[model samples]
Target: MLFQILLTLSIRFFLFDFVLFKSLRNHLKTKGYFFRKLLSCPFCQGFWSGLGVFLATHLIAYNLSFLLPMLSFGFVTAYLSMMTTAIFYPLIDKFEKNYSTL
Candidate 1:
């Protein structure tokens, strides 16, 4: 579970926050404004990315009990991962700024 949280944070910070926006900037300009806006925002991107990571973790850690209650556990795990990513974004931003100067 802890590994999943950390992996989600890394994906949110690197893939969604850095690579996607930078690499797709030109392409997004010619695309729908809403799609561009959604991808550019870290929080929005993080939510979806975290959910993705959660799904991957769920697949790896699958157990019969995890689906006993209609997949509620998976949903809750993903939501929590997303929220944690959002909450730590500011700190991650600061770290990036500092690291870039090193």
Candidate 2:
């Protein structure tokens, strides 16, 4: 459970912070209404990425039981992890910057 949450959070951060965000904002900038809208906000992209990670982890772990309950739990876990990541993002960014400088 703990590993799943951490994995989901890490995947979400990588997707939103490194991959999807840059690709959407730069290469695909304003190319489409949907892409533009999605690129404009971190939370929106984060939520989807989080949800995807959670669902993927659950599926891989073979933890799926009740459809609705599992879906709900995954979503909740995703959101919480995403939010937790968001809260720590700035601190992590600063640490990375300081480390690179050193």
Q: Pick the candidate with the highest TM-score.
A: 2
> Which candidate leads in lDDT?
2
For candidate 1, write residues 4-100 as lDDT tens digits.
6567667756765573356576577469988776656655565566567766665445576645532543455456646766677688688777886
True lDDT of residue 21, candidate 2: 57
For candidate 1, list the clashing residue pairs, or say none: none
**Residues 23-69 of candidate 2: C-alpha lDDT, one tens digit per residue:** 55676656888776665555566556656766665554444464565
TM-score of each: 0.51, 0.56
TM-score of candidate 1 versus the correct structure, residues matched by position: 0.51
Worst 10 residues of 2 by lDDT: 57-66
Error of 2 at 85 (Å): 4.4
